[model samples]
Target: MKTYLPQIERRILVRPNQTYGILNYDLDNAYPQRMLELVAGSPTAKDCWNKRTKFIAGNGLEEKDLGKQIINAKGLTIAKLLKALATDKALFTGFGIHINYNADFRITSVSYVKFEDIRMGDTDNAETADKFALYSDWGRKTWKNIMRSKVTFLDKYNPEPEVISEQVCKAGGWEHYKGQLFYFNPEVDDYPLIEADSVWEDFETEAGIKIFNNREVTTGFLPSTMLFMQSRREEAENTRPDADTYTGINIPTQLEKDLGAFQGAKSAQKIIVIEYEDESSKPEFKAYPIQNNDKLFETTERSVEARIIKGFSVPKELINAEKSSGLSNGSEKKQAILEFNDNTAADRLELSETLAEIFSRFYKDINPGKNWNIIPVTAIAADDNPGIKAGNAINELLQSTLPRESKIAALVYAYGFKQAEAEAMCL
Candidate 1:
């Protein structure tokens, strides 16, 4: 005797396509594109991704003027560039920046490149990749044909002035030479896994649950049922001209038309009627009652949502504000913001460091030193008195019978006021 059991296995493979001269991202070179679709289709995943992106970007750079300075001819500012990079980093755990150079071998303009549009060039060594391939329609569905002219090959970012000058000279000019691409993938793999990659199945499950509910609603929440009817036979001369001769009027077809009329919201709750000749030939309407799995679906959706949020390392309070209690909502939200900021500190730091290194070489008027930093949104949140409203606290303090000194002390200590300022206000 033999017993069979189902086994499921998943693997992430990086294969090189010699024709394209690029290493495929997870067998198809479309992992990032697939991830984009998955997030687009799933509400929870999209929410988590958005929240992660926003948190990572925070309030933009510490230097307001520097952030406002345009980086490219398109008027893309440093702040906008950072946000775009944060969006890709939150989604793909990687991002790419396209850098152009002038005749003097100096950086001229920088633009944000979509992470999904980039592919690492095929290389014998795993540690280094010299070239990067960029194509907008990797799916090949948008355009009739993806011609060689549509694909651009870019050199990996090299900071060495000598290398850039030599490459520019060899290519005959700066315009002829391809721009350099700054690819950031901190995960140390051929390609970075998406932030929510571990819970991708959960994303699919959540999307499936939504589709299931949509189908159920569209069908008026009807159970799967089978309709059986005895065929009506008539003499050959009695059959109508338009009737199906062999089936004698096609009762099943008529029944289907009648039943289809009752589907969807517009025709819901309408009575269904069937006529038969006698008890022996009565139509049997057998409903295979589908068990009400609303609760099961709800549970599964919640589980999948939780898993996706966890995979993104986003706090639950941030995504679903209603889940937190009304009394402690503010405090809980503040704590969640702080926690999320801490979680994304590394991401912000990486972006900040990369921008700092790149901008240090930019034109002197725009570059604001090597200490480029992005302020976390938590800085603003931390300053908030979440536990107690300041107006309410002041009202309570004023209405109390406490001495002036005591009130002033409370204001200084509890409300973060300077002692002199608190005393003057109390007086």
Candidate 2:
């Protein structure tokens, strides 16, 4: 229904260039096959697959997932989106579904009904378990109409022409950050190879099975075929001239000027995450995408580590640091002694360590007890493209819940400030 699932759980098998937009010129006509199964729930595997089959793993029936042109026409049929154009890209661009047969199969059609997700039959009420996903008008019946209607096909001379290839996607390793892992290396050299997205490993025993970041869990993989290869390269880039070098790789005017300058912030996003206090450091800190564009460091040794967030103007060393960066119109701190009577002991101890590092940088991932973090220009990115800005601790708690907005726009990210101190820390 609303199944694009890739906030970091990825397992996709796509094959579509066009074939259901219904073709019946007789390759023998009637050659249809739709069998699908994809189950993924987070916030810790939907509490371990619903505390162990109390239920979850495809049954409620809301399995739509063929994005990049996200438009599901209900119970799918335009001939199943044009015989799924045999996984279109001229023929096929990706395929990989191995979580041991992947579980619970039976997909004869519903052209991805919205990336699959539904448990218990007759959709089990409460508005068919939160309705799931439908796109727009083209839906009104609900409860997936108890699955089973009518669809059959096989042609190219009664069943023969089937050849799909071009899949070997791998999402392996890196992104430990703290213990310092960091893989995916789109060739940023020095033997780093991140560009990741396929490293999910979650197991279960069954009995009221509870799974989600558990005794055995590893995350960050969301490549469901980059939303249908960016919707068939944006429908062959409208009419290519090179379609701006192929959709300019999914526009991001620098992430919409870094989330519109941290969502029109007045003041509160901060930076200065420079690390490496000893052991002959080297990766002082370098993250390139742009901004001068030729300095992406890493040369450490003493147990090495690296991170450098951006979006300056709130660096009183890092205010209270983390109150989960949430709390508004809110006020409740000056606890006594006449609120320190306009205090004056060396500028009131630097504004009370900038209000306790602004409550410890928005509550450090909501009250984590560790003393190490380095999110820097935060973004978990997985092919939707256009990200990499103002996630440094929720862009500093959304610029402390904007009460004085009006900075229209101003982001200086040369990979976390530096272009002349990010233009002297913007305004």
* TM-score for each candidate, following the candidate numbering: 0.78, 0.14
Number of clashes in model 2?
73
lDDT of 2 at 165: 10
Cα RMSD (Å) per model? Answer: 11.4, 29.9
Query: lDDT per residue, candidate 2, 235-323, as tens digits?
Result: 32245567767865644433234433432124224332323345454232233343321122112110111011111111211222232
Best by TM-score, which number?
A: 1
Query: What is the per-residue lDDT of model 1 for residues 144-254, given as tens digits with 9 covering 90 to 100?
Result: 665657788888899688888876776678669877999998766478788888889888888899899999888998878887877645323435665555553443455
Whole-model lDDT per candidate: 0.80, 0.22
Q: Could you give me the TM-score of model 1 versus the true structure?
A: 0.78
